[model samples]
Target: MDERVATALGEAFPERAVDRTFGVGPSWNGANETVGVAFADGERAFCKVAVAGDGSRIARELAVLRYLDAERSIAGPGVLAGDPDADLPYLVTAPAPGRELLGVWEDAGDDENAGEVEREALLRRVGATLATLHAKRFETHGEIVGTDRGGGLALDPAPWPDVLRATIERTREIGTSERLADHYDAAFDCVEATRGRLEGAPAALLHGDVAKPNLFVSDGDGSDPAVGPDGIVPIDWELAHVGDPARDLVRAEDQLLNGFDSEGPARYADALYKGYRDRAGGLPPGFAERRPIYEVVRMLGRSGFIDQWVTYLDEPLESLVDRADAELRARLDAV
Candidate 1:
């Protein structure tokens, strides 16, 4: 167990004994650590603590979970205990109900998982779920600094472009290394140059990182027992914020379908978008116009985490670096 996690569990459950701790899975964010905990009395929960002693992510997640619990109909993990301001900031929550969407999506190729048909339905549900969340509109865009007294988001208001740039800075804080340092500069330049196009975007709540691993679906074979009305539940709200719905949709498609070496099958991407379109009454406004810049921004996910990608792909660092460089440049040129 991580020392911080152990300390947090001790604080959160002063009267109980812990039976064991287990790994949740690989996470790309380097600032925080999360683990699944089993108590001696038989209850289980997940504990996340900031390893760098910076509590912003903890605060963001805690506030988002509280907001979801109070306002949103969708199911999110119930907060068990947390204090983002503590010496060792941490948040504990009951485990999200269901299996990870990553496993189900990956196993869709297998005969037993009912193949691409099932996977397509899953991605569609993902798109619809995002649409449901994005339907909650905000008057202005900004970072979710915390919650208001009324149990709503306390946003530090900024223009949409500034808010988007702030997210890039936050990603840099958590994931960037010296190897692709210039890529960050280039991304900033791209966002700055496209400021005119990015203004006046719809202000909807976006799950900034929409990777399959952050989503969950019920264990039931049918969709009826799914965690939320849209038949999917999302975890890890640290990146949640108010932003352009189109940005979230673009990120969702990329995160859900793209691979290290290539973009995954086009049909799957289509299915995901189709689901979003079916729910949103068409794609979010400006989806096509703003997509290129968002694509340029999304390149940071690869460039900023090149080393992790090298390990994830089990390929030579030099080769991955070359590929990521080429890809980032290509995306910038497209914008």
Candidate 2:
């Protein structure tokens, strides 16, 4: 444990003695850096601390959780207490139940038929949860958090395009195979062509990162031994913002398609559209036309040459860049 974390916890709850416990389970989510520690009272909680000056991230997360807590419609980790004044901004919350959907999907592994069935059910649950969130009157903590009247949270949109461009440049710089090179080129072109179209889309409250890992499931103890059907609990609202709803939906769709190999891309893509429509009432105009472009944007946004693809591939950086270039070219051809 970092000495800073221990001291911060002591200050936050001055009356209680804090002991580090090894028996506590590890964190199952990826939203932020949190240490899993069991308190002396036998309560298991996650301790999330941010450096004092970097309180915005923790503040934003706390605000979202507080807003959700008030609504009481969705299942999320309940915030126990938080303080931003200490050397570390800290929050303690009861852990929510569920296995990360990515792990579940991976465990289902190459069992195609079984994976497809499970994936569909998971998709429906996710769709329903999202629908509930979107249906609520756009209110949060009784204040409008954005320019829109819906009270959705706001974030500067200026960084997204630059973020996308930097991702592409990084991938290209890393270098990869001919095939990936082609794909990267094609993806870049698609981005350039459709960038203008997305500018006009209406902004709504979006779960900034809606990938599979953030969707969790818990199982009920029963003879059936299957995962509970109440639906997935969406975790991590740190990136929640008033932005293009399509960005959120498309991000989820891309994860279901490209990130998971259990089902064919087109099949999963169709399933996502169906799920989104069931909740949102209808697809946005030109949804089909815009999907390919959005996929490119999402791919670029997620590509971290050093952290994810290149390191996982265990190849030379130049080779990784080459592969990305080829993949972009191929994706562009399809577009």
Candidate 3:
């Protein structure tokens, strides 16, 4: 354990004695470190610390969680304690509602038909949860600085394109942007070229990172073991922002369904979209028109992190680079 985590645990649980600390799961974000804490009296909680000494992410999450609690837009883990201003900033939260979506999806087994059906049902629920979050509309898109007294987001207003560009710039702070630096330039150019189309997109609360690990399956009723009435509860709100719902949906589909090269079964995409359409009347207003550019922008996830991909997929670095380069060109061409 890093010395910072120990200090944060002491700060978060000043009165209680910590019995043990355990790993939460795999997390690729180098900016933060998380651990599951077990207290002497048998209570368990999760703690996330900003190891990089930048408290902005912790502050953003604190603001978003408070906003969610106040607005009741959707279910999220209740924040037990947090202070982004602390010397070693940390957040401790009560356990999320149910099993992680990744664990639940994996447990379904690979029996093809049965697995796909179960996965589809879970994806539908995720779709509904996203819709609920995105229902909160803003006239202009901006960076969420904190919460207002009335429980609304206090945003630092900016154009949607600028806001999106800021998010892309985050890859640079982490080491990913350094790996394929040119992709960053290309993504910026693409965002600039499509600035007009991205200008008038509907602004809503977006879970910027919508992967399975960040989502949990609520313990619904006995009928469907995977999904509950509350739908899927999302955690890790540090990435939450006010952006285009169409951009959010595009990201959700890519994160949830697509794999390397942005390839995945068409059926999975269909089920996911159907769930969103079922709730939102149809896809977000500009989904179809703006999707190609979003796809182009999404390539940064691959291009910027090719090194991690080599380890994750256990392939040679050279081979992964070649594939990523080809895939990136294809996406850029599409845009």
- Writing each residue's lDDT as its tens digit, candidate 1 over 1-335 gives 67788899989889889999999988888889999999998999999999988888888899988887877556678899998899999999998887899887777765844688898898888888888888888999999888899999899999999999999998898774668888888888998999998996899888888888899887553444226777577899998889999999888888888876488889889889888889888888888889999998888888888888887789998898898888887888888
Off by over 4 Å in 2: 21-32, 84-86, 107-112, 136-196, 219-230, 256-265, 328-335
| Each prediction's whole-model lDDT (CA) | 0.86, 0.57, 0.83
Worst 10 residues of 3 by lDDT: 221-230
Better TM-score candidate (1, 2): 1
Q: For candidate 2, lDDT tens digit of each residue in 306-330?
A: 2355455567766656555555445
Give lDDT tens digits, candidate 3, residues 1-335.
56787899888778898888899887768898989988899989989999977788888888998877777757778889999999888889888878899899999857988999998888887887778778778988998887777877888889999999988887656645366778888989999999999998999999899999999887655343123345687899888889998888888889888887755788888888788778777888888888988887888888878887777889988887788778778878887
Question: Estimated TM-score per prediction?
Answer: 0.95, 0.71, 0.95
lDDT ranking, best first:
1, 3, 2
